[model samples]
Target: MLEQKHYDVVILGGGPAGTSAAITLARTGASVALCERSRYQENRVGEMLSPWIRPLLTQLGQWEQFRQAGHLSCPGMVCCWGNSQPYENEFIFNPYGSGWQIDRNSFDRSLALAATEAGANVFFHTLVVDVNYEERFWKILVRKDGELRSFKANFLINALGRSQFPHTKEKIYLDSLVGVAQFFQNVSDFAIDDRRTLIEATEVGWWYSAQLPRGKAIAVLMTDRDLLPVKPKDLEAYWKKSLLTTIYTIARVNFWHSANKLHIYDARTSYQDSFSGQQWLSVGDAAATYDPLSAQGIIKAISNGINAAHAIASSEFSHAVSFNDYNEALLSSFATYTTERHLYYDRERRWEHTSFWQRRQGNHKFLYA
Candidate 1:
């Protein structure tokens, strides 16, 4: 076993939020240790990067490099939401121009690399098994390839996406929404019209498909967990049946040569009762998760990470004022999100009779479970 190391801040998970927080703290001369469970080789699902990400990345000194990362530029979106007919929503007049369809493996690796360059110690393939607080510091136990190590920090940051600390407040899941998705290969030759993301609403749920970087594409069916098949083997059949129900998304799926097996992921809206504690705080999905329809997953994660880091840097780990302000901001933002989500779901009345749509039609707070 190696000697226990102490740092000013210890962060869990190396996704956008973790890396962003590490970069912010490291640049301020704070000792930061970031732990990630993956080696940046896995194919993570979140791909859409909104146009608003440019300002956030630029603020973190990573915009110029991200621009040269070879991600596909998404001009706009083609949505068949409230009505059956599809329409174009171009970004021609937007100040930030177009969004991006990124390869998560590469995009996430780049962010971790940036954090390393900023002087943070990044541990890949490391899992945090336990955490304890004593003597005004946090004690973390981590394991990698059967080897155990320990770390101590004055403050803690959880950016583990959907995963949360066992001791923190419980996550209030808004709905039982899940995405059954599949990836297709050899799609670089897809039509220019297919370059934009396609969103089609159906009676059962909604369909989202988009062209990905490196000659690949993705198609997903978002619906309630209870609405899916009971058996895992029957999910493909259900997914195919759902695909047939979409008009525009099915056409986009046809362009791909072949698809991999189906994978299910939680796509629900959730938030914790509190985002911060006495000496720790959560960011990204760990703080609050949004629906895919908002296309703000990455945007929100990075924004919260930067904001949280600034709050931490403004005062001591035990200071209540900055943490209080951070908590209040997160709650205010989540309240606004609930209102907007209800309005968007209410826009689709064609499926009002279905259980899936019925759950989303009323007040957003009522949907929480």
Candidate 2:
């Protein structure tokens, strides 16, 4: 039997949320352990960083390191939803600043490593198997190298991404099937003048394309559940077929090169059990997930982690208040996103001639707050 080690806080999942929380808690002189099932350098989407995250990164002393890693700066977004009149939204990140288009693999790893440097014990290749609360502490079971180990902590921060935890009946959110494609190639000729133009093609959910460093372009496609099958393996073929069915997507493909290599990412949104016990608090996508169309994934995750750390660092009563406040804020954010999504669909309904727009426009379930 392995001996159990104790810590003030134990964080599961080493993504942005978990790392951020670990770093924050460690900085406060709390004993912290962060466990990750996979290496942080895995390829994934949701790479577009909102300007809102810049302040937090700066506070954490990571902004300079991130910029030194050679990410592309993005000023704003240009949106086209199967319509002639496209919408443009510029972000004033600072009084006068811009956002970024990052390589997600490098970005995620760097954040996790930063937590380690901040004095948090980080374990990669460790899978959390069970979580139980006993007498005022969380007892976490983890499998590392096929060996079972246990750890005790005063509090547990669950930052496991979507669908990582066991599902329960009280969780009410439905799953959304989102398909994405990315590639890295020398496409300087096809580059748009505005780096922030994340194009969208309605009938499908949305598509964001941006230029990265080293003459590379990243294009992501998000499709509705009814239009695209769940978890299609051959994403290139599916993307080509989706483009053929929609005129808007066809124009988008025409704008880019046909020869570029394509990398695919499949994403989903499911309800999370936000709380397991008095000492366990779920953060980031572990607590709740949303559609990628909002472009709030990274920012939201970081914010939740920071909030969780603050709560855990305070007294017990303060922790409960913070968690309640976090939940209320998340609810408000979801409501706002749904309202905007519906409005976008309403605009698409006036312009697009397809069943995709019709179905989305009439989705009464989308208005749930």
Give the number of the best model, judged by lDDT: 1
lDDT of 2 by residue, 272-351 (tens): 44444466677778876766766778887888898888877885423243366666666666667666766765766543
Tell me the whole-model lDDT of each prediction, alpha carbons only. Answer: 0.88, 0.72
The Cα error of candidate 1 at residue 31, in Å, is 0.3
Of candidate 1, the 10-residue stretch with the lowest lDDT total is 360-369
Could you give me the TM-score of model 2 versus the true structure? 0.85
TM-score of each: 0.96, 0.85
Q: Alpha-carbon error at 183 in model 2, in Å?
A: 2.5
Cα displacement (Å) at residue 187, model 1: 1.2
Q: Where is model 2 more than 4 Å wrong at Cα?
A: 92-96, 167-171, 186-193, 229-235, 244-276, 316-322, 350-355, 362-369
